[model samples]
Structures are given as C-alpha cells and as structure tokens.
Target: MVDSIRQYLSWYGFLFSLGLALVWVLMRIAAIARADVSRYFVDRLMLWISIGVVFGGRLGYVVLYEPEEFLAHPVRILSLDAGGMSFHGGLIGASLAVFLLGRASGYSLWALADIASSSAPIGLLCGRIGNFMNGEMYGPPTTLPWGVVFPSPGPERRHPTQLYEMLTEGVLLLVLLYPLNFSSWSRRHLGSLFGLFLIFYALVRIAIEPLRADNWNYQLAGVAVTAGQIYSLPMIAVGLVILGRSLSAARLRDRV
Candidate 1:
C-alpha cells in the first residue's frame, strides 16, 4: 500500500483534490441552506479562486518574508512553488475572487462569504497536512512524546503545530460552523458566519502563535511578534466590526 501510494501521490495532486472537494462541499452546504449562488456561477468562482489563491499566496510570501529576494528577481513571483505560500496572501486573493464572482454573478455577497467561510476549514485541513508533509511549518523543539523529528528541519523533536492548526482552525471550526449553516437565523444573519469565521480563525491562530511562530517569529525595535499574530490582529478587528454590524442589522429587522 505504501509503495503504490508513493508512486501516485504528489503534493499538487492532493492539493487539487482538496481544492475541488472544498468548493463542491461549499456548494452543497449552500444548497442545504438555500443560498442564491447558482451552479454556473460557482463553477466560475472555483476557477477564479484557485488561480487567486495560488498567485496571491506566492506573492504574499515573497512580499512579506523575502522582499530582498523579490527585489532581486521580480520574475521569480511567477513560480508558484518556488517556496512556501502565505495564508494571509491566499486569503486576500480569495476574498477578491469571491467579491468579483459575487458581483458578476449577481449572487449575495454575504451568502457567498458565508458558504466560502464555512467550507474553508476543509481546505485548511488539507493545506496544513500538506505543510506537515513538506516539513515546512513545524514548531520549536519539544520534549513531548508526540513531537516529530522532521526530515528537513532536523532530528530535534518539535511540536507538530501544523496538526495543531488543523485541529483548531479546521476540525473545531467546521464543527462550530456546521450547525449555523442549517439555521434560519444563519441565513438571515448574512455575514454572521463569515464574521465568526474570521474571529475564530484569528483566535485559534493566536492560540497557536507560540508553536508555529518558532521559525517565523519577527522582531522589531526590541519586541518579538509572530507573523500569524500580526496578520490575525487586524482580522480580529475586521471580524468584530462585521459581527457588530450584522447584529445591529438583525436587530433592526426584528423590530420591523
């Protein structure tokens, strides 16, 4: 089984399957909740989102982590797999894609956001697993029994922060949001689920900041900051604003 799997398995293949599954599952959930997204529009949305994530993630990584390298060879941005991709970048790209898709397709923006947000955990789960397999996002050295000695990083036992994120942002988030997808309240609340997604994701990421931040920590002046925390802070504020506005709107509608 291991030999056969090795022959056929590639990171790209796994990613493609996961991306397709994420979109398909999202459409199904939206249908279950009766979102206004059409089958035709979704097909286009998926295509655009795939392109956006790949391009944006790569660009984000270069811009944020390796500006010098980018300045040295601007054309290197064209290489999707030249190095690690950034989630923050992918998020920006996906958001733009969703906005464009929603506008062009005449679908409800919040509805698309809600569906996309909920289904994102599926992709996160896959992405985190990919990170683990690639030996890129492991945490600091650990004495814990479950820590893995990644081939690329070293022989030191490090926390599997990638798996930690999979559990927190992927599994737990899915469980939390699954119920909302079926609710009459959720449908009316519009951006509520999306808002909650951003909030929950930020919270979870911050929680794991210490773990994943080991390799990617940044220091400025005299302070240390994790890249995840930096990106997540603004998102938390954005989530709060969204939730606040959504609740206020819901309240007004209730009075009507």
Candidate 2:
C-alpha cells in the first residue's frame, strides 16, 4: 500500500504543495503586518525570505552536513535539483533577510520576526510531507505496527520520522503559536512569539534526532549527541535571551 501510494504520488503535486504553502504563509504574514506597515512591505520581505530559504538552505546543507563533498565539487552547489536542505540554515537565512528588511524599511525587526515565525510551520509541514512521499528521512528499523518499509533503505520496516516531524514541528507548533499570535500580551511584547518558536522548534528537533537514521552522531561531554542537537543548542540560548528581554521590557512598561 505504501509503495503504491509513493509510486502514484505526483512530483508536480508535491512541488505545487510547497509553492502553495509558501503563498499561504506569505499572505498570512502580510495580512498581520499590514496593520503596522505599508501594504508592500510584507511582499518585499517575503521575496527576500524566499531567496534566503533557497540559498541558505542549500549552502547550509553544504557547510553543515556535506562540506567535504561540496568542497570537492564546487559546481554542484547550484544543483538544487539533487535535493539537500537544512532547516537550521533556512532559519538563519530568513532571520538575516528579516534583519535586512528591517534596516531598509525602518520597521521593527522583532515584529517582523514574530509574523514570519508564526507562519513558518505551514511550510515545514508541507516539506515533511514531501520527505515522506519521497521515502527519504525515515528512521531506523522498527517492529512497530505502523513502521514503513521505504524503497531506498532495503526491505526493513522503519519509523516514519517525517510524519513525526509533521506532527510536532508543523502541527503542534502551529497550534501553540496561533493563540499566542492573537494574544494582546504577544502583541505588546514583540519577539516573545518568535523566541518561543525558536525554543519549541529547537527542543522538538533535539528530541527527535535519535530517531533519524541519517543523523551524524558524536560524543559531547560523554553523552551521545547528534549533529541536529548540537545545532539546536544555540537556538535555545537565543530564544531565552529574546524571551527574557521581551518580558523585561513588558515589566518595565507596567511600572511606568
């Protein structure tokens, strides 16, 4: 059944879904930002973010995961058709784009970040589903009833880590952020939402790293650690800093 579904699933449909996800999230972010800035501000920001996601995701994959291979073949950097992307890299790229837009437009960087972070999960959800359809990013062999036998990794049944990501990072994050996005407290304390997003996503990524068969493993302070966990550690720290500042600013406002 799984093989049949994978075979019949349209690649075009997957691409379309990704495109659709981008459009939907961009529109939603733009709508939220419209109240604060000009109608075109969000549009321009989204364009930069799109560029960032492509370049940053690609470059990140090269720098972080496959530096040796990409270094050997510099020409392959442009070959995005080969399929390699890193979400951490994409986040960094998007954050840089947001910072650039903020500087150019004289807008609040934190506000823009909150808007982008709120809608990011939709794109993630679609991307994970695409991973599943391609039978990539599956976990180690499993005996569970729901274990999937992917085509590329032989006949052994494996955990559907892609679906797990979809549920946690995509759906769960969306649900958590949706209410916060609309809350008055979040509006007053800009950056809190974005901070929470970073924290939550980093934690989830770390939690699931052990399940991913392809993750690079290492020893950190005698603890078994994956590359994903190492990359995510900084996000937690940054999130805490941002969240602390937001709350501190809010408290100061109350005293005034």
Candidate 3:
C-alpha cells in the first residue's frame, strides 16, 4: 500500500495542486491589480468564488466519473496534487460561485461573468501547460512533426492536444474577446463578449478532443467519446443560448 501510494503521488502529484494554486493567486492579484473594479468587497467575493471552485471542482470530478476511485481512497479526493480533476467541474464550480457572489454583491451576474471571462483565458493557458507538464491530459497518437512523446503509461508520439487547447481556448479566446473592448457589442450587452468566448472555445474544444489520446476517462453518448468532449457540450449550449439572447436584447435596445 505504501509503495502504491508513493508511486501514485510521485506520478500524479505536484503539478495538479501547483497549477490550481498558481492560477488562483494570479486571478486574485489580477482582480486587485486592476483599477476597474478594485474594491475590498470585490476581493472578498473573488475569494469566496475561489473557494467554491476548488471545493466544487474536486467533488464534482469524483461524483461525475471517478466515484469508485475517490470512494476507495476518500482522502485522495482532497489531494489535488494527485491530479484527476475535471475542467467541466471547475467551470461549473466557478460559475456557481460567481452567481452566488454576484448576487451577494448586488451586481448583475452577466456583468460579473463578463469580467470573469475576460481574464479567464490567461489562467486557463497556465493550467493547460501544467497539464502537459504533468503528462495528464494528452492527445491521441499522431505522426505529425509537432506530436509530443508523453512519458507515461506508454511512450508514443501523440498530439499535444492540451497545448492546442491552451492556445485556442486560452490565448485565442482572449484575442477574440479583446474585440469586445472596441465593439459596441461589449459595452451594450456586457456579457456578449464573454458569451462568444464560451461558445467559440467550446466549439474549438469539440474539434480538438478527437485528436486526444484515448484513455479510461473518455466517455460518450452512453458509450465513449472522451471526457473532454462530453464536458464541453453543455458549455457550448449555454454559450449559444447566452449569445442568442444577448443579440436579441441588443437588437431590441437599438430599435427602442
């Protein structure tokens, strides 16, 4: 048991917790560093949301797909350093925290969502790179020149899908959202840019997942399609709904 535990921790620990910690610290610093909405209250709210994200993400991952693994070693669930987390779970957690915090702060949820969305990609990029370093979430086998040879489970040339996601969902997402700053869409609808960010990233993620390596975590329409894809569907749907609603509202406001 000791050797098994040691091996598991050695293989899957460090990067997991460190990635989250770094992101969390950066987010808080960014919030405080910014003059736009810097306030004690805002900082407090962000703290609460961060707590929610960490807790919710861990619990959600276990509940959603790895109940047995977590249940067998209940303590390990809290050991994020041992890895095994779901981005979808973290998103849900963050969203829930944002909603609750927004309400408590007497702020529009959409506006807060927009702010959260704006700075999110940078943090995501960091996390994905961490994922790559940890050799956790990698892509399927590939003969491409850019394919990376992840050193875990089995050594083979695989798509560095996580990095692809980091660029698209993180860096590219930020670039796409930047236009909102000058466009009337952002000022008018507030969350319109954020909505587009979500939709765009989810769409890109759907495409990226196919290239990812097949693992036990992958699952599909009651079958198996990869956990990454399965988790992205709802985000795509929600983003679409938000985008559609925001557009209609903008149109109505313009007519008025």
TM-score of each: 0.88, 0.89, 0.79
TM-score of 1: 0.88
Best-performing candidate as measured by lDDT: 2
Model 1: how far residue 8 lies from native, Å: 15
lDDT of 3 by residue, 1-256 (tens): 4555455456344544554455455445444544334455556656765676667767778887678887899887656655556667777788888888788777667766766776567667776776787686788778899989989857778889889988997789877775354444565785676688788877887788776664445544566576667777887788888988888887898899
Candidate 1 local lDDT, 134-182, one digit each (tens): 6767888899999999987678999999899989888999889857877
**What's the best-to-worst order under lDDT?**
2, 1, 3
Relative to the true structure, candidate 2 reaches a TM of 0.89
Question: How accurate locally is residue 254 in candidate 3, as Cα lDDT from 0 to 100?
Answer: 89
How are the candidates ranked when ordered by TM-score, highest leading? 2, 1, 3
Model 1: CA > 4 A from native:
1-9, 78-82, 220-222
After aligning candidate 1 to the native by TM-score, how far in Å is the CA of 120 from where it should be?
0.6
